[model samples]
Structure formats: C-alpha cells, structure tokens
Target chain A: MFRLLIEKELREIIGSTKFAVSFGVCSILILLAFYLGAANYLASVAQYNAARAENLRQLEGLTDWLAVRDYRIFLPPRPLTTLVSGIANDVGRTIEINGRGDLVAHDSRYGDEPIYAIFRFLDLDFVFQIVLSLFAIVFAYDSINGEKERGTLRLTFANAVPKAHYILAKLIGSYAALAVPLLIPLALGSLLLVVMGIPLSSNEWMRLGVIIATGIAYVGVFLTLSILLSSLTQRSSTSFLMLLVIWVMSVIIVPRGAVLLAGRAVSVPTIEENNAKKGKLNAQLWREDREAMTKFQPSSSSDPQRMASEFQKLMQEMADKRDARMKQLSDRLNEERTNAQQVQRGLAFGIARVSPAATFALATTALAGTSLDLEYLFRDAALAYQQAYAGFMFKKTGVNLSRGMIIMRTESGDPEKPKSINANELPVFTYSERGVSEVMQAVLPDIGLLLLYNVLFFAGAFVAFLRYDLR
Target chain B: MESGQPVFEAIGLTKKYEDETLALDHVSFSVRAGEIFAMLGGNGAGKTTTINLFLNFIEPTEGEARINGIASHKDPLTAKRNVAFVSENVMLYPNFTALQNLDYFSRLGGKTQYSKENYHAVLRRVGLQEEAHTKRLRGFSKGMRQKCGIAIAILKDAPAILLDEPTSGLDPQAGFEFIELLRSLRDDGKSILMSTHDIFRAKEVADVVGIMNRGKLIMQKHAAELAGHDLEELYMKYIAGHIRDAA
Candidate 1:
C-alpha cells in the first residue's frame, strides 16, 4: 500500500506542469552554480599563481639575501569552496609574512569586487537554502489541506487507510520525487566539473557529496514544515500563507536577525582599537630602544670592524628585548580579542541555528573549509610560514627581520655590479585544507540538527493529522 | 442472517461540534441487508454529519455508529472496511485520470486485486464513457465525477455504501439511471443509506424514508406506509416542526 501511494505521488508530481517548471528552474540554478564555481575557481587559481610569480619576480636581481623582498603567500583556491562559497571570497586571501610583526591579510575578493558582494555567487548552498526550500514549500504547502478542501480527504479517510501510513507515504513520496529529479542536475553539474578539469581531490569530492546530502536534508526540513503547516490548517490558502510567513522568517529573517541581535548584545573590541593600542606601545618601546642604542657608544673602539661588531651586537640585544615585549603585548591583545570574538560568534551562530536554513549554510561552509574559520585558518597557516621564514632570514642575514627594522650593508664591494640572490631556495608555503574526517566532525552537529528538524516536523505533522478535522 | 439483522445501524447517535452546534441529536436508525434507506432533510439538517459518523470521520458525542454490529469509533479501520462512501460533489484528484482515481480509491478500499479491465467494466456499469476513462478528472463534469465515485464504490464491493446528496447534480436521465443502479446494487444485497433533498426520487425508489429537521429524525416510514401519502407535505411539516408534537 505504501509503495503504491509512493508511486502515485511520484506520478502526480512528475505529471504536473508546476513540478516540471520548478524542476527546470532548480536544474538551471544548480548547473549555473557549478559552472560559475568552476569558472571562478579557474580564474582565482590563475590570479593566485600570477601573484606568486610576481612576488618572486620582484626579488630577481637582489645583491644580497637581506635586501630580498616580496615574500607574500596567498590562500589557495579550493575546488569545493567554489561550489559552497561560504566565507571564501569574503575573507582576505593575501598575507604578507615579515619575520616578526602582527600579520594583516588584505585583498579580499569581496573587498576588491563590491559588485559580487551585492549579489553573491549562486552557489549550491544558496540554491538549496533559498530556491529549493521555496520549491519544497510550493510542493507541500497544499498537500493535505488542498485534498481536504477538494473533498477528497473525507473520501480517502472513509476507507480502511490509516492516517499515519497515508501521511508517511506522502512525505516519502514527495521527497523521492523531488530528490530523484534533483540528482539528475547534480550529477550533470559534477560531470561538468570533471570536464572542466577543476581537479578535486578525493577528500574534496567526499565533502561535496556530504554537502549535497546536507542540502537534501535541508530540503526535507522545508517539505516537512510545509506538510506540518498544511495538516494544522483547514484551508490550503491559509496553510500556504502561514507557511510563506514562516519560510520568510526561517530562511531570510532569522539568521540575519539573530546576528544583529547578538551583535547588539555582545560587545567585542574592534580590530582598529586593538591595533591602535599595539601601535602606541610599539612606538614608545622603539623610542626608548633608540635612546639606549644612541647612548651606548663603544669605549676606546678605534678599529672599524670591532666598532661595527659592537654596534651589531647592541642592535641585536635591543631588537630581542623589543621583540619579546611586542610578542607579550601581541599575544595578550590577540587572546583578548579572540576570546571576545569567539563569544560574539558563538552567540550569533547559536541563535541563527534555530533555522534549518542557517544550519545548512553553516554546515556546508564548515565542510568546505570556508566558514568564518577560513580567515583564521589562513592566517594561522601564514604565521607558520612566517616562523619558517624567520629561521631562513636569520640563517642568511644573521639578523631577524621585523616589519620596520632594516639592516643595510655599508661595505659594498662593488656599487655598480648587481648580484641576484637565490630566491628559489625559499621555503614553500603550502596551505592544506582540513581533512575529510575533521570536516565531518565540524559538521556533525549541524547534520544532527537538520535530521532533528526533519524528524520533529514529520512527527508534528503526524500528530496534527491524527487529530485533523477531515470533515 | 436473520430478517432483523442490521448491516448498518445508528444507535442513539448524537454529535455536537466545538461551537456547541448540535449537528446530530439522539438519532437512531438501522438498515438491514439489501435495504435502501433514504434520509430527507434541508440544509444543515445533520444528514452529512450522520454519514461522517458512520464513516468514522468524526466521533459522535452520545452513541455508536455501527457496521456489522461493531462500533465505528471503537474500531474504525475494521468498521470502515465493510463500507464504501460517495460524497455529493465527487471531487477527485484533478491531476489523475478517471481510471487512475478509481484504481487509487479501490486500493484504499482494500480492493487491490482489481485489474484495468475490471476498472473499465465498472466505469461502464456506472455509465461513464470508455473514451473518458483515461481523461483527467479536472475536465470532468459534476455528473461524470459522481458516476466515477459510484464506480469506485462498486469496485470496493463492500457490504454497505453511504451516499451524501448523491443525486444533487444529476440530470433527469442520469438520476433515473442512478435509481435503477441503486436497485441493482440492493438486489446484490448491499445495504445503502443515502441522504438526499430529492423527495420525489426518495419516494420513488427508497424502501424506507427518514425525515430529519434540526438534528432530529422527526418521522420514518416504510414505502408501503407512505404509499398513499405525499412525501413533500410530510417533509415540509417535519422541517417546519408542524409534526414536532407527535415526535
């Protein structure tokens, strides 16, 4: 009986013109997402490679290693990030690594292209969360109440059919109908990626699969929501209007409202204020260090080499002391800011997760390694790279390279002749994505939330339908 | 079964909606095997409510609507299995073909063994055209849809059938054909309880006639007892409470 009902539902939906139209729109959007993502990823890779080549080219004819510049490493584009998007474009991609200083990333895609920010790319996440959710509502909002309004509900119930089985069959049938057609577009999009040579790793493909599964779960939430609303109402129009209002709140208003509310509620120190404080302390320390250096003249130092050696030792000691103080201040301020930001983010996302759409967005982003954590992960990778860089610079120049601290050679052997340093010998800065297992862990809670939503809505609809006034 | 063994019964059945509007009031009736009982009433006369109770679509406040002596509310699924229902308007799934609707409803009624040929024959028996068998119900007229509903009921082959205003939109020819069909069904020993406003048809075909007004069954008579009487006059008197003192 259940199978027959499912078969009927699939036929009914597939035969309807609305389903065909909506399905076509969904296919186009999904395909567009895949196409745009692949194109954007290709463009980003080219831009990233060009930037790296340019950085290396700037260090071409350096006479000494100490004079070598252009050591900026960029965040590499991930294939899945193109499809999911998340915060990949919003976060900065370029970080300049100077041996010792606070690193500030710049050149964010969104910052560079304000036009894209106005209406973000139509990624898979957007399509599933917004467009497909609406389609789910359209498919389900009138399922029960419309039957009642048409006088079919009473006729159906007049038989030996159990209400539970009927409702279950409806849910499963509609989900299968929607999901099975949707898979066609998704498969085509994936094939498109392969044809375009985006080169997704095994781990990336796994994440994409999970993301698609999550999108289905998110869609199930909306389908259940619509059914629940339909069962609770007497008329299809009333059910549809009520569901539309709820959809607007859950998909559009809740996440943004929660963030705004959390922002107003939680007080996180701004980046500018923290930077200003650090700058003020830095200048004060530098002035004191400069005075100490000027006061310490070598006593009875007639030898030029000896005097230079002493000056070098004195500069080294001062730099060490300044570096230590700066480290202490940076660590404390960064810890404080990080703590505040964590609290603020926790509050914001916690409230936003009340909506399954938000849950899906956050989950897909985490799985794709492009949530707010993307910025931190990029910076952390750059910092690790900076550690390696400092060691490399220390070995070559015998002096640590702070942002403003410079060392010049006053004993150039030949002023007219230029020598090129071995820039190719520099350590490669590689940023690896989070492993699939780690991503699964990060997204597990959201997957549970989505499942919970599906279950609760189904159960709610079941209960409401049991008590429904079929007459 | 014995002569008095009722296949369908409403024993002291009463219903009051949430708004405290009494839709049915202590109505007691029974239809034996092969009996054709027609209930006559005006609008909001609790005729549909009574059918709803018998189908277990709504619970009665006071008493039992029974099928085969089993209370409908006590074991609804089992009780409903022995009965088939055809609503007045016969609204079916618009997206489905006439044959599709019949197949779905028959399956719901526990008649999964019905084949396509069986569906076509039954639809023809109900006077629906072979050409319209595969046509979607969205384009079907009121009479056609009603015939489809009767086709579904026939396909169910249950012991009893409930019809609410079953002749409301039928043309005179179709209405007469429906009466003839009901007689054929009765000959096959299917108990039928129908609600209708057509007093003339009720007098013409019904074995027993019931007159209800404001949730109460004011008068009931066998066709033999109503042989020399005017059904319209009695119905008007019952609806207007002119016969209230006698009840």
Candidate 2:
C-alpha cells in the first residue's frame, strides 16, 4: 500500500510541468553561480599577483643587491587559494618590511587602495546561504496543500496508511529530490578544484564534509517549515506566497536590518579616530625622546669627531625608542578597534538570529575560515610577522635605517637574508587548523536553532494533519 | 441477498446544521434483504441527508444508521465495504480515461487484477460502447458518463448498492435503459436502495416505494399492494396533504 502511494505521488509530481520547470531553473542558477564564482576568484588572483610583482620590483630598486637583507617581500596568493579562497586575499599585504620596530605597518602602498577590499571574491559561504534555502522553500511549499487543491488528499487518506507516515514520505522524497541536484553540482565543483591542482588534505575533506552536512541540515529545517505552513493553509497559492515572503525576509531583509541596528546600537568608531590617537602618541614620544637625546649630547668639543659620532649613535637609539613607543600606541589602537568591532558584530549576530539565513551564513563562513573573524586572526598574524621581521633586521644590522638607509654592508652573501638576522631563526606564519570540537562549539547554537525549527514545524504539522478531514 | 435480515436500518436519524435548520428530523426507515426500495421525495425533502447518514459523510445529530447489521458511525469502513454508492453525477478523475478510472476505484476498494477483458465485459453489461473506453472524460456526455458510472458499480460487486437519483439527467431512452439494468441486477439477487423523484419509473421498477416530506417518512407501500392506484396520483396526494397540514 505504501509502495503504491509512493508511486502515485511520484507519478503526479512528474506529470506536472511545474516540477520540471522549477528543477531546471534551480540547476541553471546553480551552474551560473559556479561559473561566476570561479571567474571572480581567477580575476582577483591575477590582479593580486600582478600588484605584488610590481611591489617587489619597487622594493628591489630601494635596496641594493647585497643589502636586500633590509627587506622581505610577501608575494601574492598561492594556487590553493582558489579552492577555499579563505581570508588570504582580504588581509594580505604585497609589501613586506624588515626594519627596527615592535610593530610594523601593513602593506603601506596597498592600504591606500580601498577599492580592492570591496571587490574581493565572496566565498562558498555566500552560495549556500542564498541559493540553497530558496530552493528548499520552493520544493516544500506545495507538498501538502497542492494535493488538497487537486482533491487527491481524500483518495490518498482513504487508504489505511496513517497521515504521519504520509507526511514523512513526502518530506523524505522532496528532500532527496532537492539535495540530489545540489550534491551533484557541488561534487563536480570540488572535482574541478582538484583537477585545477588546488590542494586539499584529509583534514580539509573532513571540514568540507561537515560544512556540507550543516548546509543540508539548514535546508531541511526550512523545508520542514514550508511543509508545515502548507499543511496549515487551505490554498496552495496562499501557502506558496507566504513561503516566498518568509524567504525574502530571512535571506534579504533581516540580515541587513540587523547590521544596521547593530551599527546604531554601539556606534562603531571611525578609522580616523583610531589613527588620530596613534598620531598623537607618536608625536609626544618623538618630542620626549629628542629632548632626552639633546641632554645626553656631550658639552665638550675637544674630541669633536667622537662627539659627533656618539651624538649620531645617541640619536639612532632615541629614534628606535620613538619607533617602539609609536608601535605600542598603534597596537593599543588596533586592540580597541578589534574590541569595538567584536561588540558590534556580536550585536549584529544576535539581531540576525531572527533570520535563519543569517545563522546559516555565519556557520558556513566560520567553517570555511572565510569569516570576518578569520580576517581578524589573519590580520593579527600579519602584524606579528611584520614586527618579528623588523626586530630581526634591527638587532642584526649595525646601521639604524630609521632615518632611511645609508648603504650598510656593501658586499654580502644571500642579499635577501633579513638584515642583522639569522635566516632560520624567525617563526613562520603557521596558522593552526581549527579543531572539529571548536568548530562544533562555534556552530552548536545555530545547529540547535535549526533543529528547534525542524521540531517545531513537524510538531505543528503533525497536530494540524491529525485533525484534517480527508473528505 | 441474505435471508431473514435487514441490510439497512435508520433509527430516528437526525441532523441539524450550524444554522439550526433541521436537515433530517426523526427520520427512520429499514430495508430487508432482496428488496428493491425506492425513496420518492420532492426537492429539499431530506433525501440526500438520509443517504449521507447511511454513507456517514457527516455525523448525525441524534440516533444512527446501520448497514449489513453494523453501525456505520462506529465502523465506517466496515459499513462502507458492504455497500457501493452511485450519486446523481459521480465525481471521478477527469484526467483519467474511463478504463483507468474503473481500475483506480477497483484498486481503492482493495481489489486488483481487473484486466482489460474484465472491464470491457462489465462495460458491455452496462451497454457502454467499447470505443468509448480509452477516451478522456473531458468531452463525455452525461448519459455516457452515467453508463461509465454504472459500469463501475457493476465492477465493484458490493452486496448493497445505494444510488441517488440515478435517472435525474438522463433522456427518456437512457432512463428506460437504466431501469432495465437495475431490473437485471435485482434478478441477480442484489439489494438496491435508490432515491428518486420519478413516480412513473418507481411504479414501473420498484418493489417498494417510500415517500418522504419535511424530513418525515410520510408513506411506504409495496408496489404490488398499490397495483390499482396511479403512483403519480398517490405521490401528489401524499405531498399535497403533508404540505397543507404543515401550513
């Protein structure tokens, strides 16, 4: 009996042209998005590489062949970036530094180019949140009420099968149909990535699997909600329209509204304010250090050349102190900026909870390591790298390059070595992979919310259907 | 038809709509096995209400109906299995062809393996042409659809058949043919309960005629017992007297 019912359902759904048309539309949309994503990633990669090559050329002109130890150029994205595309391009620097400092400025040349930041490739996170959930709503909104409108429900329920079994069968069947198209395309995309020689480790595979599973679960939650609404309503058109409204609210309207609300709530400090404090601290430190250097200058002029050399060394030391003080001020400003941003993002995330779309986006971005959180981490790593490079150069070189380099070590081997630094001593930019437990912890609340929606919808649908009159 | 038993019994069945209109008030009737019973009533005479009580389409406000000695409200499927229903204009899947419709309904009643040959034989028994078998019902005439419906009832082979105004929209020729079909089925020992306003047809075919007025069974008599009186006159007299007394 159940087999016959399933066959009947399959037949009816296939006979309708709407199902075929919808499936076709979804497939085309996904294919288009895939091509677009690949194109955008390639374009960005090309631009970043070209710019980095140019920056490296400029750096070579600044440092002599043997004195290249004063600088280390951080080049563009590696090939693996195209697959996950992570946060590498967003916070990366083309210009590198080997100088004397406790902290170093970001790629000075690129910081002025704000246009690059806006046009960066949006990652896989964008695809699942916006496209997959809409498809889910379309698949499930007509599951029940459409049958009722066609007057098939009476015959379907006239059989000895329970209504609960019937609803479950529909959910299972539609979910399978919806998930199949997405899975095949996603698998093909992954294959293309591999064929293009983007490296993926076993750990990356595990992470990707979880990300896909979470995506399916998120879609399942919405599908169940649509089904529940369809069951509760009398007309299929009304149910479908209601579902469309929900999709718009969750996917488009609510997230932006939440961000706006968060912005207004805590008042994110402007970059101008942040930079003003850094400038003020640098000036104060410079003035105090210069006064100290004047006091330390020798009063006697008997040994005039020695006094001049000693005064030069004293000025160099004082310059180093001023640089250290400026670095401290900059670090504090960055820390404050981070704290303010964190508070705003937290408020935004809280407000965005009204929409499942926001939850799915947050979870997927975190899993892919393409989130703003990941950007912050990368920024800290880059800053630390810059500081370490500067420390190595200052300690190893005899010349203070603060007043601009005066041709130190004219003849040397391995010109690219960090000035005044051991080549093998500094720490590499080794980012630790996020553990599964940590990933789960980060997304557990989202998973809980989705499950909550799933349960609530099924429960409401069950109760509503139990009372429905088949005739 | 089984002997020594009432196949249908209505014990003061009553139905009141939310508007407080008494659709069926203290209506009661019974049919013994092998009896061809005809319910004759004017429009709004509670004929459909009585039939719905038997079919359990809606719950009764008071009392109950039984089919094959089983309470219809207590066990709907059990009662419905013992009976087959044919409305004035039966609703079927318009998308399906006539043969497919028969096959679907047969399968719904837990019957399978109703082959093409069997379906053709049944259609021929009901006098529907074989050429009309595969055509969709979109363009079917009322009489043709009626024949197809009779084919379905014959295919079902239920012990008791309940029909509502089976000849309402039929031409006189089709109506005569329908009566003939009923007679043949009755000869085969099938018990039938039909509701109609056709007095002459009832006189010609029915073994027992029951007239209802204002939700009440006003008159019931064996056709043989009223052999001398005109059924038309008897029907008019019953309706006129009942309405006059109520006024």
Best by lDDT: 1
Model 1 chain A, poorest ten-residue lDDT window? A400-409
Q: Residue A447 lDDT in model 1?
A: 97
Q: Which stretches of candidate 2 lie over 4 Å from their true place?
A: A34-139, A158-161, A180-199, A283-329, A391-437, B1-10, B14-27, B30-61, B65-67, B76-108, B115-247
lDDT of 2 by residue, A17-87 (tens): 55577667655655554455556456656776676455445444333232554344443343323433445
The TM-score between candidate 2 and the true structure equals 0.74
lDDT of 2: 0.70
Local distance difference test, each candidate: 0.90, 0.70
Where does candidate 2 clash, by residue pair?
A396-A420, A397-A420
Query: Which pairs, if any, clash in model 1?
Result: none
Candidate no. 1 TM-score: 0.94
Give the per-residue lDDT digits (tens) of candidate 1, residues A340-450. 889889999999999998999999999988898888888889989999998898888787675346666576566676567788888999897778888899899999999
